[model samples]
Target: MLDTYFNFLQNIERTLGGGRGVKYGLPSTLQKVIALFRVDAAEIRLNQPILAELRLPSQFGDFNRITSETPYTEAVITGAEGHLGTLVLYGSRQWSDNELRVVHLIAQQLGVALENATYFAQMKLKTSELKWIDKFGDSLLNMLSSLQIQEVAGRIMSATKDLLEVEEASIMLKDYESGDLMLWSHTPPEKDLSIRLKPGQGIAGWVVEYGKTAIVNDVKKDPRWEPAIDEKGGFDTRSIIAVPIILDDEIIGVIEGINKVNDIFDESDAQLLRTIAKWSAIGVGNANTYEALKHTTEQLADAKKQTAMAHMVLNLAHKINNSVGAVRVWAMEMADELKATPHPSMEMRLMVENVLHNAEETLLMVRRIRGATELRPGDIRPIEVIEAMETALQFSRVDAAVKVERHYEDGIPRVGADAERLVEVFLHLMNNATDVMNGRGTLTLTCRRAQNGTVEIMIQDDGQGIPDHLRSKIFDPFVTSKSDGLGLGLWMVKLYVELIGGKISVTSTVGKGTIFRITLPPWEK
Candidate 1:
């Protein structure tokens, strides 16, 4: 009989969350319990405070489920929190005291197993919540760091709805213009975008007026509840969590979340809003300061303005880089965790991978914006006009009239260069050549060894050439002759050339043609 008990116990352990353990793994384990005990029937009845499972326990075919009046042996099932459910056994004969203990032992293990499973499930849910919240923080920081202040409020309000599981959230900035609070961001956005509130009038106003966070579970019971805004916006107010956006001891705005979608407002939601509010303040201030500096820079002479702008951008990039690093760490940790986990969801893995890719891309873009050209110098083979050829090839698809000629000398030396940037240099020049030719001229690409232990390349175009006056300033930032050009192309080409220890020059005529010559040093020993 003890052996039989051990086998049954082992069976329960085997199917703890899976097999017959309880329809949890124990669903079949419970059915096996009947056979092991030689009982006619058995049932597990759920008690108060359902942690996860909601369905009534199976009683098998034609067997009655346990009830208050049923005469049967009982084994109470309990978890860490206390009584979770009950296990009942029905038989043809009287049961002994020893048998009852074994029955209780089995029931106890089932309860413990179910409880463990519940906690694991809860942990996954919390992990998911934390993941999104971290991502939300990253999103907000990136927006603020980029000076995209105009879009930040709406995004914060909309995202807070999902973060707090709420319906109808808004960000309200204290309006000095009208001595009131103006609704800056609204979810399920209203047709009338700008709505104002009187000073200290509503819950949001009260937060700003008092310089504190507000957590209102029931707006109906709070005297500070303002129904006018709800009536005007055609939204209902149930629960509220509003936080003040403070900067340097001054409250600038309010973030109000109205009516939680599931449960009422809690301290956790208030705390999240508080953190977000601080970030929002930084965002607002950065946008204002950036604009002011931009205006001032515009007023300065060209040389001074370029130097000042470069400094400003590099500083902004440094700040943003630190924030972006945090995002990257989160992504990397998420990826490692996903990989370590057994049977991780495909969607989650893909999402983490996508985040990592985006973080790397954004980092590169930030560096680019700072005018910081990162390089990976290597022993690159002789200049491949392949990139320019590819561009010409692509252009050839559109117009068969344009002729492309590629010339390469057999003994060209390998150059030290960042190959990717080198490709960009050629692509940009080739694109210009194709554009100028206007579909009916010659685009020549040449690559050869130079006399001075260097590699030489040239892109010559036979359609409308650059004016001599413009050629001198052609490599200067924003100095484009094209009517629609931002003028950064030639500047970038010059920058890229110089960065890799190379040189670029150009000669052109107004009506004849243009040739861009580039020389790159040979790879070091």
Candidate 2:
């Protein structure tokens, strides 16, 4: 519509005898009126005067300086029944009434053209803004699926920088424990920047402290401007828009766009940033929730595993106790019959004594095994190391060919432990020694008080020592050299010993012997 009107003006100028054309190509009809009035210059104004100007048909020097003596006329331009602006002509000629009417008719058309052009430009600007807003919304939606707080924050900051056309942007979240604003993410990737602010410290801080949006057009002019940041980062901040990231009526953080490119920030920029801040808060909230849930799941899985292990231990203890009890009964009966024989030979006497001792130790071991499965803090007490070793040795059933010796210091302090659990530990070490010896090595048990006020026990055996490769992981579960062993004995032994406030260690040489040392805290009355 505006182009058609402009074409009409062009044809009018051609019809009029105003030489070839004018500088701004005024309509020939309007040109004839300007010539009749001897106007040197003409202007077409819209909404505000001087919005546009029409070229003169010929050189009309310095028309702006035309005095009252000069011939000139002013006419109002009306469009859509509303006053658009004025058409003013400066010249030195008399204008007839017919000529004046012609100018008015053309000025009215000019007004409509101007109005249409104005609306067109405004619509184009709005279209661009809507596109950017759509893109911004899309970017935020993508961030919603992010499970990492840092990733969400970085995306938000990058989107803000691009959408707002800012030189720098950052997201800062408050540290709940320390009451400080930690810079979580920023655009342009400032690897060396470590920004932390207290509440009410900087522009970002002010937004957080007040839970409001702030627009600083000139940092130097605003008293709230914090120069320390610029000085530290070597940046000159000319403008900024900071808005609080609010969640559930609480400000969790702040989003800031600094130094808008080629323009000062306005309320409109603040409004955009505020919208983005809302979405960012939601993204951060979702990410945090995901992380918390993941941690909880892992903890629950660990608890379940521990529960299963405990059940397995209890079941196995019950089965072993039943079988061990039967063996103890038969062994005791045979030992009694051997001792009852009159004038028994020395060898026969020795055999009977060994049988009796083994039976007693087997019974003690059965009790200990059962006790191990039912361990509790209240069942713990001070245990004499020598008595526990004696029971463990007898139960170990060391071969008659293997020499067994005991060296226990008199008055050695008792150790705080579960008696049955402690005995189980000794049984594991002795059994391991017997397997390495293959039924023909020396096994020595020793006990003494350590300088640390703890009772130290050592079980030394001259057997085919543990292979060097297996020593490091000997105490680990499911690690063993025995074909029939489940490999958990030493691991459990280590576990039980530690539970009773003790430490266990081993020293061994391949093809020679191995020594297992344990230190237990002394029991206090």
Candidate 3:
């Protein structure tokens, strides 16, 4: 044994300066030592396979041939702190004290060499993991910048599969309305599968329900394994790791990797998945917040536009009223002078009367526009629906060819409203109905008591109804289907109805007709 040690040291000295640098070449060194000791056979085993096996020359033949029946001496290679592996030497004779001591020395040297190699390998793995994490984080940031939620989710699933070397990965999000776990994205997409899990129903659901990570090395052995999914999709799940995606201390979803490639899932894989889930949560939250902010900004812009439009309407109404009032006074004076003249021609009399009537009508229109645009606070009182309808029809400029029908229910309750404003609302609606009918169709006005303690008045027109695309936004400011309309009539009607604690809705069918329903609170007294 002593001579063998000397020869081993000489071999190391010769190989050290060969510039290959401490290539302990442990297997070769062990083989040389075994041959020098003349052991029948020898073998080295590590807790994990760190290097190739070493063997002595065989006249007695292979290690397997020696078998368990053969006598052997074994020494555990203990590192500075832990057992690295075991070293066993087999022979037909019992190992003597000297040979045992030599084996112990060799074991110690092997332990140190194996420990260093293990550390180097682990360091390399950690460096690679760090680089992967950095690249993944950068990619997520870019995805979130685009604010495409589904695209981000798909990329996350792909990155998870690559990072963990998994055969399949999926992202499951909680459906806000259904309260079910929905498969939002998956790698190697399954077009025919529609998977949904309730809370506490499956592995992914369990993670989300309990807000913890799950690592199942063998799905067949786990009670939480749900086989229905596998059976439905013809998929076999051998192992799985699921982690909750938490945001604001709440679990929003779960990310799962299935059947880790060529191996069972372990704590290290679970930890990696948890790290990825954290980044995914952040990306999802940011994207949702960005979408919300964008919607709010659009709403604010619309409100500003409506405010500016209202001011313009008020200014125009005032300017036109001033001009029209002067013309109304001049026409009235001219009509009076023509009537007072004796023997005046009938043509002059008829023309003067027409001018006076037109001037009065123009002044009335200016007043209605002013009332609708100004939105001024007015007297509120019990208003009889029939009386208000009569006033509106009296002021309306309906075409002579159009037919008008009125149906008033007896004993209907009066509505609580500003009589003057309500009159203006009805007048605008009647005018709109007339314009749509194009001087030929029927305009029907009906009044009744609604079940909800309100007065319901419906104005139905058998004119070409509003188009489908324009119906939804018909009441919004500056939206109109008319070439000569200001688009403010319906908007003002909506604003006035809402201000008076009423609701208005319209049902229209293109090329058929339209019905506008207005409901107002019934007068208590």
Candidate 4:
């Protein structure tokens, strides 16, 4: 293993001078060891990025920091000269102690060598700056692609630390509404730095407040730079550089790199930092816009649906009114014909009188229909559960065909929903159950007090149950097990229940029966 490490070091030198820098490349011995243990996350972060970019394997890809609490196994090794870097094996689960020891040694040697390479390469301006700029750009792009904003910020923070050769790094974002700057991401406390600053309160805040970049070559001499490292993170503040993240003339956030490792940050460092900050601003703006548009579009679609349903109700009322008018005309004609035929039989005469009476009643119902509307905020009030169930049964015409059973708990609490809407739901469910019975089986409606201060309604039918395969998608729009169904009834019922902050569920046993349970928050008794 010793000989292999020595040889690999020689190969790294040769590769850096002759080929492109890669981030990870393993020696034959390390490769064999990694393969034997089935280690999927073998990584190499060479100290000398130039050598790393040339010698490291491309398969390992890039490394970034995390915003959330990500559990990982990490080992840090210091060289003879006290040079520091890290070897992180992230993800959960432990490796053998023997393998861990070797990993630590390998990571130390790799970090030291890379560090040496970077120290020597810093003398060259163009090559070092170009490489760091490319790395920073790649890190920003990765953050933009991430689903979580904090994770992306974490990655950018760590990458900035590496590229700037700084001891600590952080990203602070502004809350426009609160006018506060918050620590969005930072290296863990164990990583040798602790720094926290409020927006417009500390050096981080100054950058956001002024919308400009600030560089303190020496922290001791700066007045705006507060030395509260002990109060915040328990570390000394020496040198600091902060840059604002500006988007569309507004300062959205700031990124700061603290304590340069070797030299004070120069114009080259500032150039690279500003370039990264520009790209980051663009990514953040796009994400914010997308989230806002999604919320607005959803609300607009809901409004349109309610409007369309209201229009349907109006049209239905008009049709019913016209039918009632025709019935009134027919009854008047029958009365006139009966009166003109004075010798008519008693049965015929009585039938004519009955028809006239029914017509008058039907006209009164038509007037009521014109005034009746869908249950809305103003139309809803506390109503008795059993009474609503009975009304629904009458509307569904189920009582005439199916055997009806009603189980009501005395003093069952009222619910906070539209009484008419509840009736509509009961009617839909009862009619479905009746159809399942095909005019033979029993239809049961039960209302009772529930354990959670809510009312429970169960509609059960002793008929062929819904198929198992269809149950999973039963609430989805346009999914129906019925042959003649429009497939919207169950979907609409679920939507209405959810809108009212209630729940509905179904359970069925094949060849036995199906039961639907609905629970709603109760109104005051």
Best by lDDT: 3
lDDT of 4: 0.65
In model 4, state the lDDT of residue 337. 86
Cα lDDT tens digits, model 3, 380-495, are 67888889998998999776787888899899887777788898899989988998888688989999876666889999999999998889899876689988776877988987
Q: lDDT score of model 3?
A: 0.73
Task: Summarize candidate 2's per-residue lDDT along 259-340 as a digit string, tens digits.
Answer: 8998888877887788778767766765665454335434444545544665675566567666766666776676677678
Rank the candidate models, highest lDDT first.
3, 2, 1, 4
TM-scores of the candidates in the order shown: 0.32, 0.37, 0.41, 0.34
Superposed model 2: Cα runs more than 4 Å off? 1-136, 145-148, 296-525
The lDDT of model 1 is 0.69
By lDDT, the better pick of 2 and 4 is 2
TM-score between candidate 1 and the true structure: 0.32
Off by over 4 Å in 3: 1-158, 164-242, 254-270, 292-311, 324-478, 482-485, 490-525
Where does candidate 2 have its weakest 10-residue lDDT segment? 16-25
| lDDT of candidate model 2 versus the reference | 0.70
For every candidate in turn, the CA RMSD to the true structure comes to: 28.7, 33.5, 29.9, 24.4
Of candidates 2 and 1, the better by TM-score: 2
List model 1 lDDT by residue over 1-525, tens digit each.
544555566556567632123345655676787777677677667675443342434464236544555567788886544687888777656676546656777776666556545543433455477865555654544434333456666667655776677877888887774678987777886556667878788888889889888999988999998787778777778888999988668878898888888788778888778766765666565455435433433333344445554466557678889998899999999999988998999999989888889889878856554442445444344544445446545634326677778798876666666555566677778778878888678888898876666778898998789877787778776688789986666766776677778899998988989999998887665
Query: What's model 1's lDDT at 94?
Result: 69
